[model samples]
Target: MISKNTIDQVFETARVEEVLGDFVQLKKSGSNYKGLSPFTDERSPSFMVSPVKQIWKDFSSGKGGNVVAFLMEHEHFTYPEAIKYLAKKYNIEIEETEQSSEQKQQEDERESMYLVSEFASKYFQNTLLKTEQGKAIGLSYFRERGFTDETIKKFQLGYCLDEWDAFTSEALRKGYKLEFLEKTGLSIVKGEKQFDRFKGRVMFPIHSMSGRVLGFGGRILTNDKKAAKYLNSPESEIYHKSKVLYGIFYAKQAIAKEDNCYLVEGYTDVIQMHQSGIENVVSSSGTALTSEQIRLISRLTKNITVLFDGDAAGMRASIRGIDLILEQGMNVKVCVFPDGEDPDSFARKNSQADLQEYLLENAKDFIEFKASLLFEDAKNDPVKRANLIQDMVSSISKIPNQIQQEVYIQECSRIMDISENVLFSTLSQILAREGKTSGVQPKKAPAMEVVRSPEAVKTKVDELFELERKIISLLMLYGTAEEEFEDMVLKENDKGELVMEPEIQKAKVFEKIFLDLQEDEVAFTNERFRELYSRIISLLNEEGEVNIEKFINGLDPELSSEVTTLLMEEEQYRLHEWERMNIMVKTKETTIARLVGETILALRRFLISQKIDDLSRKIKESSEEDTKESMEDIMDYLSLKKVLSNKLNRVM
Candidate 1:
């Protein structure tokens, strides 16, 4: 675990604008910066970052928090991972406290796998750069492929010796367990013999979006016809090929900046593009694209342009991915390289400006690409052309946005030189067939139960809830402020008439709230509020003044998020600087006594009304033998409710 002092230092040193500016292109909007939300697809910006508050809010997704929360949401980082990222960015050294033996044993299995993968990545890189054979064979292969030393080092290229157990023996000698080595697909063990999996191959480390090495892909340089040319690590605890896209860690910022991503097929294709100054590109690791990979890019940008190698078989295999992208509500385009060239070779052959210009001029929208590719084969045959038209409609129906689907349908009709009515009818029939075969059933409506005075009861409950929230806010914001509170004391005089005396007393806000609630036997109805109430009172008793920032840091994420939300509720209004406009707004400090008294009176009245409701229900359901007793209880509750209602100036 990270030390509290280190976390605080990170929070204090890191600026929200500086951190978010790395991933988002923020434009100055008054006191805050606004950008398109990284979490959703939108044209206008709804993501706002407040430097003064050290927080950000994405109105599009309803997610808002401090700098750490932005990383957790956008990068999918854990709390400690986010803190460490900020600390590194701000050049603050992190200090982690030592854990107990049992605490170390209880670490998560996923984290252990990540640790092993990280260690193996460093091991492989060291082998490539330091060892003699690695310098000769591995470094030579990458250099021959037109990769500079800078590129090789940036990608963390490496090599494994051709011997069976060379890498395995060294790993075990370094105290790494055999189980983790095998689990991470770094070693293969059989009986008493253990061998390296990527022997005699140049290695490419595949990284997660947050720059953790998840797995490796190896390329064999040998000319052995029986050996596979390329090998990838098997699925492991931390690496799922379908869910990861290579080069995403390097490409995320560029993708967000360009509002577009170039999708290729191999790791080398991604590396060469980045080396050529086009950083907004990722690869599917030579696998057929999946919905998961498409969704990954969708988080950064809404536009994807897939670059094909111009091979017939490869293009045929990649055509299915187009519909998958469309199904995710993303705009997709297709760009093919020259007849004999792939992304790697083409990028090397052209200057950066020429390559960028070629891409911009050649990229075709998906509707046109689909129609042109399919039209060539069906030009001579009427029957085949009919099937082609249906295929186009099927792809169109996969789009979730109705307006986009209609636009594509019109484009398809124009390209096929067919009537729009015919295409629309075909699409409607396909949709109906799909709906019928989708196994959807009409849901039965639930029966409604009638309740008495539900609105009145709900309004009363909501008032109490608001009062509870105010009480908690006071305790958290100003629990130690001392103030004068008037006490109501009732006594019987000599004439047997009741008289009331008001006594003034000075007490802390927390003490006053605690005694008032206790006198009325009032308890919070919400579980979280109740827990906070008890904790606040306990802390006040122990330390007199609660250090809210320190208290929040020690809480779990959920509770901490709730507390931050409460504190930041009026952040926008506070940032407006109303005082500069010569407008004076009353603050909580000036009217805390009135606020506390009103809140307590409202809460007590609500509780009394609830008691009356419960007694009324009991009277209605009472047995004949218990009817009289129930009625008496209802009468007492009614009188108490009337008295409390009078106190709050409410009509019966």
Candidate 2:
């Protein structure tokens, strides 16, 4: 277990905006920052981060939390993992109590697989750097490829020995389980024998965005026609090729800095591009581009430039990925290298400036590039040409943004020498076909149903608005003020006659609001809201002043988002500074007291109105036998109405 002191230090040192900014692109909005929701697919900004509060919230998804909570949600990390991540990011030294071997053995299967993968990575690195054959083979290969020793170490490049079962024996001897080794695809087991899966191959460790080794890619050095030249770890609980992008863990910062990502095909393509000074490039490792992978890049940036080899097959495959990228709302550009030269070779021949300039001059939008490439083949055959047009229209239809689709459609029409009307008709047909097959009904009815009766909802909404405003007033102003109030009580005299007596008591408005909430048996609509209210009340009671900044900082993201949202929303009515000065507006303390009192009264009135309506219904339905019960309910309702009326009059 990590010490509480260390956890506190991590939280104190790690800034929420700085940490989340690595993954999310934030633009300042008033006192907070807004960005596209990372948790959901949307173009508009709805995710908010409050620097003052040190927390974030995705209003669309209702996921909010502090820095630790954000990591837990965003990365799917455990509590300890989140703490460790923050610790590492902030360069805090962590001291944890060591777990016993038996206790450690009780870890869950997923964690065990992670441990096994990590251990495999370290063992491979050790073999490559420590052993004679590994040095001559793996290190030499990397050096030949122009990978600096620092780069090699940074990427953890390693090699496996040629001897069968070399890795398997070492892992088994180190207490790692064979089941996990096989599960992670590090070891292959057949009949009664087991051997390393990537024996004699240089290892490329593929990592998740958080830098956990999810799997590996191995390259064979020998010229065995029967053996595959390149192999990847099979899909496991921790690794999915379609969902994982190689080099994202290392390239995220660069991608964010440049606001663009360079997409390549193979493992070496990524390494070579990085070594050649293009640090923002990543690879699909020759797998088909997937929506999941596009989204991973989309989270970092919306612009991607695909680097393709000049071969015909490579061009066709590269074209296939463009539509998927567009579907994820990303802007894609294609750059085809010289014939027979891939990204690795092409990048090696040019400086960063020249290579970047080449990409810029050659990069073409997907619609323009695809239409130009396919236009030649379709020139003689009108039917093929129409089919190509349909294919372009299909790609355009997948784009989520209507404006983007329209622009692409116009571009396609102009380039293909087709009329805008004809292309639009084709787009319409494609959309109609998709709608029918996918069962996507029109959204008109659902939108209409959301309309509510203005008059009926206005009263409730106004009541809530008034209450919220009053609460804010108290929170901001009279959170520390004490006031003297008269309390009425009944007492028996010596003659046993009941006498009304008045007692004076000193009480703070913050205390009054807290007690009133408890007395009314009312609860907040949300748990986080309730917790924050309770905590604020506790702070006010103990210190006489509530530090809004400090309170917000301590809250988890969800509560922090709610509190920030409440605090930052502009009031409908604003008193000008000069006008307020002339009138000598109520002191902060008095204003808070009045606001709290008025809010309670407004809520009481709303509740009383509801009760009156319920009692009226009961009175109409009651029979003679239930007359007494109905009468008692009616009296109670009348009493509540009187109290509400009195409170409302004071507030008004």
Highest lDDT among the candidates is held by which one? 1
Q: What lDDT tens digits, residue by residue, belong to model 1 across residues 1-652?
A: 8998899898778888999999899988777788888877778777777675566777667677777887877776768889989998889998868988777655555566677778777877888899898888888888888899899888888888777888888888988788888988889989888889999888988999889999999999889888888899999878899999999988887787688999998988999999999999999997888999998898888999999987867787789999899989999999988889999999999999999999999999887887777788898999989998998888887887777777877788788898767877777787788782322122247689877885566433467668888899888777888888766555557986444456889988898899999988787898888988888899999988776555665666666666656655544444445778998777777977767766776777678677768867777787976878877777766665565566557898
Displacement of residue 84 (Cα, Å) in model 1 is 5.6
Candidate 2 local distance difference test against the native = 0.78
Candidate 2 clashing pairs?
Answer: 64-557, 64-558, 65-557, 65-558, 66-557
Residue ranges of candidate 1 with Cα displaced over 4 Å: 1-64, 73-80, 83-109, 436-652
Q: Whole-model lDDT for model 1 versus the true structure?
A: 0.81
Best by TM-score: 2
Against the true structure, what is each candidate's TM-score?
0.63, 0.64
| lDDT of model 2, residue 425 | 73
